[model samples]
Target: MTQPPPPPPPNQPPPGYGYPQGGPNPYAQQPPYGSPAYGYPQQPQPAYPPPGPPQPPTPKGKLNAQAVIIVSAVAAIALIIGGGVWYSSTKDGRADAKSGDKNSTAGTTGGTGDSGGTGGGSGADKAPANTASKVLFQLPQPAIGADGNSATVDGSWLTDTVYAKSGFAEIVGYDPVKGTKLWTVPLPGPVCEASRHTTADHRTAIVYEPAMPTKDKPSHGCSQVAAIDLDAGKELWTRTVKSGDQAITLNNVTVSANTVAVGSTNGGAAFDISGKVLWAPKPTDTCYDAGYGGGEKLVAVRKCGAYGSRQLKIQTIDPVSGKVLSEYAMAKGIESASIVSTNPLVVAADVNYSAGDGSGISDFFSIDNKTGQLRTKISAPGDKYAAKCEGITKIEYCTKVVVGNDRLYLPTESHDGTGEYSKTNEIVAFDLATGKLDGQRADAGDGYTISPLTMDDGNVIAYKSPPYDKGGQVVSIDGGSFAQTKLMENPATKAVREVEFDMQPESAELIYADGRLYMSQVFADKPSTPGASDYLAIAYGTS
Candidate 1:
């Protein structure tokens, strides 16, 4: 299987996808209401106990004293009744979950039970062309308890529903459009790092201990992989995997077709959808990491030759029989390869620095799904790489650079090395048949600073946020005409005040699925009430 990019150096931590460099402190307490941090805007605080009914004015004249007395009595009675009704309402709306509890009070029922919808509003089927956005709902950071151990919550979009892990070791399903709490299922442990996949049939999740292991305390714990029936909120099956004798924790898990594959530092494992083990952990020479090639083939990479002279090898395997169908050796100077797209079977190759300074060179290849042959050598845009995978790569890039029926949608930048965007950017559609670039260059979001989110119905959903500002917007790029249309803008009322010069492009996500775009951001609105948790704002894309 194709591998993810190499991890960060020992001194630095791996950056979070769709999150800030170090990520938000899960154990950190909520900030005070109405208080702006670093000059960002504050969410309007909620009023408690509401204001009391207004008192009627007193009568000034004696002749109207009797009338005043009758009026005052009636007014007092009415106030009492109103107050009673208000109190009842508050009582009915009282949150069942405690201050430090991460469980949803409304959707606490276990196993596929519906929390029902709390209707807010629906995103319009057709929205104006302007980049106007509104918050559909706010999801609070789940309370992981006071153990100081917190799960790194990651969200996956399936159609209009979002499946996110709560800090409390539970996966909560939410409806982004209706602001509804759909369902919650407690997991046996916290999520394994970058171990989630959303497919048409089901959602795959890997839960394990301590999001990140340190030098002293490596992950000796067990990592469990489970297939979740999205609609039923039930686990199809779960298998626990150890880090092997070396304490090498599991790294990536992917589900494609009927197979679910898990990769680790030591080796990897693959299983059928029914939890049937198709292959066991083996040496890198035999199995290693694998991902879905365009069709039913599983692509895996192995190192050939001695430690120093080893070359990268790509193997195409029959996923069901676990048999290698064919193999291809990458170029002699290519050091490593990462899967860029599963549908198009695209892989991005890194340069072998030991050979020589391979600057101004970027290599991409598309494999023929059936023959496992090198189908086409996709030309990198000028001197720029289609993907910037030098450091810890983002998930956005992992699924971007799409390869379609006959065209290739690639994101490229004219300038590099700024750690932000190039001076010029374009989504170039390449004619797959000729390996030549398409003439029509589409204008992407925010110039060269935008990131590709997803491709739907032949259109690319792109995301853009101004450097150091909260004014981000999601736009759709027409696959053919290359025309761009802004779908939605930032939902946050306030943004970070300090200048974020080199903010990570994956710090936010704009997912377009089920005919709607769901936006999820780190910093968002605060819920009303003293003990209420601050929520991640969810914005919707109208038709």
Candidate 2:
């Protein structure tokens, strides 16, 4: 859910770091939202709304809907409940999750859970032959509550027929082409965390509360775990686990084969896709499973040691049996770690809270999942790369970083553009096996900042947020030649540009498919001022 808003004015504070540099405000919620953490003119950002204990867990939060950021004809965004963004019709609500496909695409999400990228080898994912695009739809934000809290809308999935998105307390499926509501499944409470991964059969998982929050119980605890049939618009099964008498406050959830795993400070647990309990928390005085990374394989970031001297262990575990197949321990002094890919076994960490730039990362670790051995470690100074990690507990939250074809791709931070005060960036790759820069570069040109979105087989689909006066773009970068093919471009109208650019690429969920692009938010918040505009999501299309 990131990138392309005009970079924050350089004068703003840099990304937020917890104890050392201007650290987390002691009064802040571990890390309060919009804190001085992530410097202004934000770029690819840290994972968000992080749940669980707050020890080595100081990270930033920017809610994305589950899609990409590309704003269009929004200020003219008249909310037509029946004809526009929100439709009452539920016909043809179900969609086909493209499972069993061999090729990766700019749009299809197959391997990575909600966060991983999959390639689309089909015509739907090929690069754009032209620069044609139009506004497809726009969703109005839900009226904010008195609490001024941002409602969580964490999950969004693109199936063959339906574009499923999480709403306030429901999951809504929409017609991808028309941007019309197709079907919706109501939930007891707001969504907490959604697995970025979808099964070959279109099933996924999420963690939510048992009931809506109230003043007395501001949060019921992110305790409910359920499986969703993305193609069917239904909840397959729901389950909960407890350590002693308290329901485990799950911070993250992921799907791996037939297992759905959830993790938190209390510990971790697993449920079969069918909703059967596979394992529950086994509290130990010294360690616990903090969270997991799904897709291709299931991995866990186990935290050990007491408060100030905690250590992290990365494990490739058996999804069904909850057994550790292999494990690798991080060096001492590293506070938090985020998983970039599970199969290739890549991890990011801000060693000793050193990423003062607010990207939440300082290095990348490539390891062997089978033997649990470190293969190579690449130093990515915060000032150089736009790639980011939620870095605290959610082991799988990372953005502006794409991995494929034995390579690791990262966007370079914005620097002086060829023109005036304009800023620009680049996408560069590194050999994952050797942890060395491959020297392959894809320039975002000038004034346009490019961020990696999803994969198109060996190619990569990237979003280019335009200069303040222009519209956004989606392009395909060749894995071999490093050439970019324009797929779609948004309208540059002031109404559209002003609204969408405000959403900022680093803070919105962006999903691109065929010629259509969807930009959304994981949470909807109250307007800071009276009559301020708020949008839930926006859509765009190119013939």
Candidate 3:
């Protein structure tokens, strides 16, 4: 009765329906009322209307568009992760390969390998231990005459004056190796007195003074220069020059490849190799020392004024052309002088005197040969410790300053006067370029002194005075570090009346020829048989 059941729920179909009921029945037209529709199977109506809009009747056996998109996104994410892992692994592998290659190369090249190679062997490794071999030449005696004058050891030849039966003098040479006589050359005359025998470039130069004549005859009063052959013991040539009424002495006679230069009491002169006078006798106030510098230059010291006067002159002349290259007027009161031969420069020292006491004051000057200008002047210590060229009486006074291999070596003697001969030797080395001391000064000893100090290939070889002996000790010193070692020792004699006795060594020289150290000694001896001056040869080992 309620209005006919609300019009049958507004004309609603049953639980499930497809299109309009009167619309010719959409499935009826398609499958004859669902009797075996499409594949021949009868189907019941769905309990509820098939989802909304029937889902557009999906095609049979085909994937949906949404499902295809979801599967594709998942596959892309997996591929990205896999690619990242593979790239990281490949890069690490390449780095390892490069490291292995570097290690192999370093091992083959001998590098101090801290990475990628074995670190065992290198040039920094220490060397094996082995004893270094050395040779030593010893001479028992090496001086001549009671006064020890005119004694020298040049190389393998020892030259000195020996007393003859007729009260004459003779110059002799002895083989140092065998202790046998090499040769004997008689003096020019019975009265002729020998002074010094020096060698340069394997040749010997003999210097002497003629004997003075008595009331029976007038004295010649001349000095002679003779170049002698060392091997043959014969005089090559002789030249006699007048020496005023007084005795004229020679100093530093040097023979080089093309010239012979000698310093005399009055002046200096240069001669050719064949004895032709290059520069004739030139008058100088006081030409006491001279030497040949490198090239064609001659360095000489001249006393400009009278004795006790202050002014002295240092002259550098051209040996080949006799031209004055440079002249330097040293301090006013110069008493002594010394010249050192170094490249591009020349060093000279002047010993000055005080006003009242005449005490010694040394002034050192460095001159540049290229510019002819004074480079620097250094004032030495006071008189008590100053270095002076107190004549050639002591070789230390003459050869105290030595120049070699671009370095300058200066030896100073102690002034306390407490040791043997009242001398203590000390050596100092300086760099020539910078004019600075290279290392700490070396103290040779208190009593032992060195004379004729020289450098050979950066090694300093000097004749040292031993304690309680007048003989000499050969010492080798390192130039770089001032380290010293005594190479050999020569002892002096005790007997005072012996005629032919071994004397102390006054001078020494170190000659490195054919890998041997050849040393010659000139000893003052009075032989029991009364012959000429006794000379000896001493040869030792060198490396």
Candidate 4:
């Protein structure tokens, strides 16, 4: 094409500049005949529509230069805000992954595979209200076979013992908040069993008995009872009792303000803190289950008759002096009975036989602690199969009975016709004062054989051992409505074994002192390499 009038000079404005100061004309009318329009020259039509809708006329108070500056500043601020939101979302995702909670959904905290619930906080912020009452502490190791025998939580310190390869047990004190070992006390022998009992004021007493000898040798004797200083971890005093000629089986031991009671193959015994014998019951054929009541009386159960058709003799003895304050002879008709006492009341259970097919029966009872008198005998409303108990090898049929402050919690296992332990679930709470069933019966034994329940402030903390599973779960039952809460999952290991590879699991003994739930476990597993003695400690309030 003929060089279109040679393009205007590159650096200078196009020809026909009409305005001064090199500015475009403010008022210029276009000439006819296909020429540029008024005020400016005509450009080619745009290939696309205008970027946006036409702007409205500027307001009277608006400033053109300052407005441009403000608009740019507002745009910058919006971009900064948007970038921050994006960064925060990315950071939260990374944090969840780092916490080993990859499965957690956005906006949710803890779930089945997560350590915390949706409401869980990182540090000490009050946990989300929906979280299962948090596990204050979960011992990394199991309790059984471990050197750490008994554990008790007093204030912030958790005191326990672990066994050494040298056949001795080492006592350890741990801080629940920091998970640090506070102190340790070395013992002379391996601990067979250990328990932590508390007084009303929250003081802790740890009792440990040495393991029994093998079947080849006769039993050594009962475990020595010792009260250790909670702060010093030193023995306050040690007393040895000959519970029986055979190896003693310690069921449960409890301590009050001034007295400590130890249960063994023989009946239980109560002693003062100074190692003086307060009261020792004569050995009876039936195993004795004992608990202390307010440092004043010892509540115990004695056998009175044959297995399957046996009787229970409930007695309350004075702690200050070795004297039986009151005794009640429960007849043989009752199926199972236990001593559950808080203060003014002591509750017991009695199973009565009915005429129809042995399945028709009424099984329940309660007693007053002050008078050792029967309070109420209501017909336990449930089928026999659902209201039975386990852990009674000698006795054909039995039900576990547990006592709490306001109610009595019972778990019963019924066997199939073939005499094998079958799945039967039933938990009944009897009102301590009125002897009436509190709310409705809770079904805890279903698909599992529930053990004798434990309590902390009327809450039931017990194990549910099911078939095919080596271990059991720790469940918590609330007192207000008899609701159930699965507090923690039991590890996959048998609690008792000659040589366990995996750490054994144990249930928590709920202790509410300063608004925290304290739990302890004994871990007993063979050392992976030689030369390591098994160890155990009490872990409470997991972070």
Candidate 5:
């Protein structure tokens, strides 16, 4: 059964009921084809049946009243039916338009215009292909001696040249862009570690710690903190650091423009460039974790108490005064924490809580450096990546998470499916401000694992290696979309087998600055005698 249209709203006409006393309908004139008028392509007009001959005139005499009334009723019903069809079609068109808008916002698959494939198309997720330049230069092997550690070198990128800890007694500099030796400076002892930092004037300085002596070589016992001016190619200052009566063996060195932080086993100290002691380790803190300094502030972690029930504290200090400006204690169950970044500080650690699936989880926290307040906390996925990696040598795999430039990247391990325990490292990025996970995860293909080395210019450089494979390749992951791309390959490293030793591959000591990657290939295979592998700093272009 058909029903008449409903009445309109108060003071409004019914749908399609209003009409003007006009000569023609507004919609009657559509553009013609290929012409501005009628708006349709112009074609030869089609022939229609010729108009019928003029109808005979009706009789002018008085007509029957019943016939007139029936004709008028039929006309009104026809107008109402026509108007109903037009109104329904218009409403449907509007609904379709709204649906399209929502899909665009939610992210559509197979969308047009170069959108990334894995997650929703984001402009930032575009892969950085063809950004690496040709291999600039290959570093020569370091000179060797009777001691095995004498030939090992660790390299870091400075402003223009590559600074390296060469043979225990000297720092070597190389011209990466020009493929030439820059300068070399003699040290008091073998340099076991080196870190390059910038001063207030942007001059480069290499802060280093000498190697500890073995029982066989008592003469090499060294506990000195020294600095070398990379630009001037000379030693700036050197001083013996002592804790009580024993020499302090530094674990790492963190540097800023005006201050240098020397991290040790139980405590650490901060000093100025001119060998002035600015601060020393406090007695309350026990073991000190890694520290990082930048943008006029330094942040670090300190832990105390027993291993089972320990407390981890975060401290931010004024780089110039060495005063602890702010300190905050992490929530309970935070097993351990690493300072992933200093500027707009972020930390990554495991929260010892069981999930709904009965697995485990990890989280990254963004902290306010000034107020010691936690800003945001983002939870990680349960892909067996948050498992405790005790004794893992690769810092990127175990500790060196990164947060910067609007993204927080963590190296996570995933099952390879070939064996019950076989896994490899992959990078997962999150929103730094909100701690939301991006849908995509960056990988370095099968049989190869990726370890993050540095992040710059919306890209992250990772060292990619295969188990029991020699050498490694440098790859880049787009921070925005998590797309992976290969940048460079090095064929110098030797295959390190885990079957025999049951140890993770030793990390390739490396650092990046000014669009270049500097690596000290200590385990690389040498062409000559057995167990006499050559080592040197190799520089590669990243952007």
Candidate 6:
């Protein structure tokens, strides 16, 4: 099937942040169809001995863990579901059209190097003809122990053969098509952090506690770092670093340039893919590496200064040597920043907590990684956009947005649909180099809200959450025309929608590929009612 030619892209009058001249616009051609792409664990373990001596209080300028969770969760959920203004768009897009970083038309995919896929991932999960999907399986949530604390299951992955998910104290591999269990990799304790990146060869990194928490020792610090062979279903190696007298707690872990980097209050450390330490942490009082962003590039968010007067330095680093290649210091008053994309060097910051709506972002900085210079800063008010970031500790964690084709695509906050009491939203883009609206909007239609999953070739894979009683959908949005091609439509049965809606996109881990959609949770609480069904994950596919 051929795609229709799209009108020329509308330009945001050239007076804004450096919208370079002579750039060959991607909207110049029509694209053909059929392309684009696009966790936590279970169980309670027996109580072990004391984890360690008392730890120090959270450093100044850092939000307490409980405070961050409460502020972000409650406010984000309200903003996402309630009506709000949307950032206006200038025109439509043609997904099949090629994209590049050059001000010239010769480049392919999206950027100069980070194009169709990053984070060591492959193609999008799209099938042009498969529109209807059925529930394939559901993994039941693990029961909470008597202590009432939920288990943290932080990762999930999809390969051609297996769908791996983190469980109470292990990683389980399942058959992609039949939902059959394949293997389980047990851990010493619950997972605290998981890298979303998967190497082309199916290996990933994670951080866990050194031991399970018992009644007398329910506070095992998060200190263990390890790599897992998803294909082999085994722990390849386990490693850790120590502070003055105890294991340092790791806040985040990521993979890039053949190195696994982990960072937190103790600064940052890197290891070769096979388990050898590349560099150890060098934490200091004035500064510390909070976390890292990884993929085609490795970037670090360096926090410096004392409490009440903190600052952030975004550094594009050499993953193997732990060397800072380039650095961009965020403006004063912005104590935290979230990495949006590593290659393009996009970082989101709330700018002194002005976003108020709990988005953890008020502006997005687009930088020139080669020179460490800020190219632009796109203003993304919380009320107008729906991408949410838990920016305190997990620096690379942001939801409902995709960066590709030199653009940042995010959904508008859900607003009134055409019908009374109905709500809807659209996906819009901003030129990363110009900090201006791209002028194209992809409507989520009535009674639905769309979120970008990833880039496919030059197109985009998006999930449209359904209305109260309708089925959801997965679509390929033409990068040029803004036209949507349905790839999968999930069933709307009360039974299915109940599970789908429970796994909100902000916190849920999603894996969509080859006509299948896997939605899983990062944490599961004990069911309130006896014998009630609570799922860790629920999957659907169109075959």
Which candidate has the highest TM-score of all?
2
TM-score of 5: 0.59
Across 40-121, the per-residue lDDT of candidate 4 in tens digits comes to: 0011111111121112224553211100000000000000000000101121011000111122112111111111001111
- Write out the backbone clash pairs for model 1: 1-289, 1-290, 1-299, 1-300, 18-506, 125-543, 126-543
Q: Cα deviation of 308 in candidate 1 (Å)?
A: 3.7
Worst 10 residues of 2 by lDDT: 73-82
- What lDDT does the true structure give each of the candidates? 0.41, 0.65, 0.36, 0.36, 0.43, 0.65
Each prediction's TM-score against the native? 0.62, 0.79, 0.53, 0.49, 0.59, 0.78
lDDT of 3: 0.36
Worst 10 residues of 3 by lDDT: 70-79
- Residue 397 alpha-carbon offset, candidate 3, angstroms: 7.3
Candidate 6 lDDT, 435-476, residue by residue in tens = 999899999887677888777777888888776666778788
- If candidate 1 were superposed on the true structure by all CA atoms, what would the RMSD be? 19.9
Candidate 3: C-alpha RMSD to true structure equals: 52.7
Q: Total clashes, candidate 4? A: 32
lDDT of 1 by residue, 292-366 (tens): 321223566543332223356666665655566666777653434665554456666544332121212255677
Off by over 4 Å in 3: 1-168, 189-201, 212-222, 242-252, 282-297, 308-311, 342-350, 354-361, 382-397, 414-425, 432-436, 445-452, 463-475, 485-543
Error of 4 at 414 (Å): 13
**Candidate 4 segments exceeding 4 Å error:** 1-168, 193-196, 200-219, 242-252, 263-268, 280-297, 303-311, 332-337, 342-364, 378-405, 409-428, 433-435, 438-523, 527-543
Give the range where candidate 5 is weakest over 10 consecutive residues by summed lDDT: 70-79
Better of 4 and 6 by lDDT: 6
Q: Please write out the lDDT profile of model 3 over residues 1-543, one tens digit for every residue.
A: 454222212222112222323332211211121121100011111111112110111346221111000000000000000000010112101100011111111001111101000111112212113212132433343333343232222222332221101012345555533445556655533222221222332233434434423344322333455555444565555554323333343333444334445554444445443454555333222233333332224455554443334255566655444465677777664434555442435454434333121112254567766555666664545432223332211111223455555666666544333532344556676665566667756665654555434445566655454444333445556666767766544334432101111222222223322222333322222333455433333343323
- What lDDT does candidate 2 reach at residue 401? 82
Winner on lDDT (1 vs 5): 5
Per-candidate total of colliding backbone pairs? 7, 40, 23, 32, 16, 25
| lDDT of residue 467 for candidate 5 | 36
